[model samples]
Target: MIVFTLLGFMCATVVGIIRIRDLFSVVMLTGMFSLLGAAIYVVMDAVDVAFTEAAVGAGVSTVLMLGTLALTSREEKTTGSSRAVSGGLIALVTGVILIYGTLDMPSYGDPQSPIHNHVVPRYINQSPNEVGLPNVVTSVLASYRGYDTLGETFVIFTAAIGVIAIIGRGRRRRKKPEDQTEADT
Candidate 1:
């Protein structure tokens, strides 16, 4: 019931964001959406993912978006009705296709799922022995999937650096009158 409520809130938030013309409201709603997603992750027994979502989605991303909004327009320009209709139609079709694609996927947590039958068992059985780590999860991620982890870290680092650079440039462009006078003098 709680999950359903959270999901309903998320859906409403998405609709609100889509309809909102105010950039600030959209950014705030985006943060709210992230928070709701984190709650859903918690309900789904994924505390690690929930923590990450809270930190990245609700925390860093919200701040960055607000910084961006400060540097840009507060109100979104209205597009042509034809363009809006076409774009919405495309989005609806894409969503339907995505939902259809998931229909064939195995039900979550099914023991007979191929993932549980094959890859997971290997990780659980062999990780400690092969990687020589007492923690199976650590061994699997740090040892077996080291490159994948490294790639993810590198991507995050790059994204953070990019955001910082963009925000810094925006700050520099907004010079105070006193600073401008000092420079002129």
Candidate 2:
């Protein structure tokens, strides 16, 4: 029931995100959707995924998107679009193939999984003795995938700084005090 509700909320959020009038509201809805995904992850006992989702998805993404939104006009300028029937047909076929690929995936908790044989076992035995960290996911992300983590952090930070740099600088459209005073009159 909770999972279904979460899915419904996420679907509504996706629809709203595409159709919303206000950019800020769209960003807020995206944040809400991320939070709901985090809650679902918690229910599935994926604490690390929930943490990443809450931080990057809900918090950082929303802040970054809102910052970018502030630098641009909220109202979409384009009124109409020509048909892209070829593109739409290609996308539909691709989506069907992707869905089909999911049908033959391994059942959850099968003992014969390569995860049980190959990677997970080595991590279990070698991790505690070597790194002394109980949480293997953290150790893998910080140590094994260290370069990727560094890249991801830099990407987020760069985006945030870029947003700040562009929006914080003086722009021509900024309202002068006289304009506000005249408007108030």
Candidate 3:
């Protein structure tokens, strides 16, 4: 019930974002959607994912988007009807293909799931012995996929630097001419 409610809210926010021409409102709705997504992640028992979503999606991303909005128009320019129709058609087709792909996916939490049958049991049985970690999750993420995790961290750090650079450039541009002239003199 809770998951369904969160999903419904996310859907509504997405629709609102699509319909709203105001860029600020769209950003706000996107943040709300991210928060709802984080809550769903929590309910799904992915605490790490939920934390990351809340911190990055709802917090950092929202602030960065607002900073971007500060340097841009508050409303989006309207596009031609034909362009909108074509974009919508593309989105619909993509969504249909994705849904079709999911049709063959195993049901949630099936004990006999291929992953459980092969990968999970091995992790549970041998991780402590092979990886020397009592916590299976830690062993898998830190040892087995350490490079992947490091790469993800590096990407996030790089994105943060990019956002800071963009916002800093905007601030520099906003400096008064007198300030520049004074510095030059």
Best by lDDT: 3
| Clash pairs for candidate 1 | none
lDDT of 1 by residue, 59-122 (tens): 9899988987887779888864668878989999999999999898998667787777877888
Please provide, for model 3 over 70-180, each residue's C-alpha lDDT reduced to its tens digit, 9 standing for 90 to 100: 977788988746688789899999999999998988997677768778778889899989999777878889988899989989998998899779766777777777698
Which residue runs does candidate 3 get wrong by more than 4 Å?
78-82, 128-135, 157-185
Higher-TM-score candidate among 1 and 2? 1
Steric overlap count per candidate: 0, 0, 0
Which model is ahead, 2 or 3, in terms of TM-score? 3
lDDT for predicted candidate 3 compared with the true structure = 0.88
Give the 10-residue window scoring lowest on summed lDDT in candidate 2. 166-175
Q: Candidates ranked by TM-score, best first?
A: 3, 1, 2
Sort the predicted structures by lDDT, highest score first.
3, 1, 2
Compose the digit string of candidate 2's lDDT tens values, residues 1-185. 77788889889889898777777787899899999999989877789999999998999889978877877777665555455577779989999999899788767647886667987787778888877899998778887678999999999799878866765553434656668889999
Instruction: For each candidate, give its TM-score against the true structure.
Output: 0.78, 0.72, 0.79
- The all-Cα superposition gives candidate 1 an RMSD in Å to the true structure of 3.5
